[model samples]
Target: GAGVSQSPRYKVAKRGQDVALRCDPISGHVSLFWYQQALGQGPEFLTYFQNEAQLDKSGLPSDRFFAERPEGSVSTLKIQRTQQEDSAVYLCASSGGHHSNQPQHFGDGTRLSIL
Candidate 1:
């Protein structure tokens, strides 16, 4: 079975530019998550989805961040007006169940750099 997959692998954006990152979770997995990992910092949860429903987005830093999973399989994270502070690796993970203890599978992530 395939693990989570993210596109672009790397991106460079000038300050104030908008960037969209994409993720494809493993087939049939019901729990999906998005995270941001700044340099030297552990990944921080950005948003979560159960199937096609976005259940939690409180971790998003500000209104500039948005995420969606329209069909419960493919998801997207859009960052508007990118800033240098937004430079980091965006990670995507998926799990088989919604339970708190369910182990998650992670993707390599798309690294974004804002100049």
Candidate 2:
């Protein structure tokens, strides 16, 4: 089966612009999650979706960040009004369990830079 994948592995955006990063989770997986990692820091939970239903989004940093999983398989993360502070690696992961303890397999991530 296919493993999780993300687009543009790297992105450079000007402040105030909007950017959308895509994630394709492993085939047949039931749960997906998004996380943000800044330099020298651990990944922070952003949002989660279970088969097209967003179960948790409490980790979203601000209103400028939005995510979705329309088909339960593929997901997208969109950031509005990009800022220098928004620069980071956006990782996506997938798991088979419903409980939060399920370990996730992560993609390399889309590194975004706001210049």
Alpha-carbon lDDT, every model:
0.94, 0.94
> Which 10-residue window of candidate 1 scores lowest in summed lDDT?
95-104
TM-score of each: 0.95, 0.95
* Deviation of model 1 at 48, angstroms: 0.3
The TM-score of candidate 1 is: 0.95
lDDT of 1 by residue, 1-115 (tens): 4889999899999999999999999888899999999999999999999999999999999999999999888999999999999999999999997677578899999999999
Clashing pairs in 1: none
Q: Which residue pairs of candidate 2 clash?
A: none
Alpha carbon lDDT at 27, candidate 2: 88
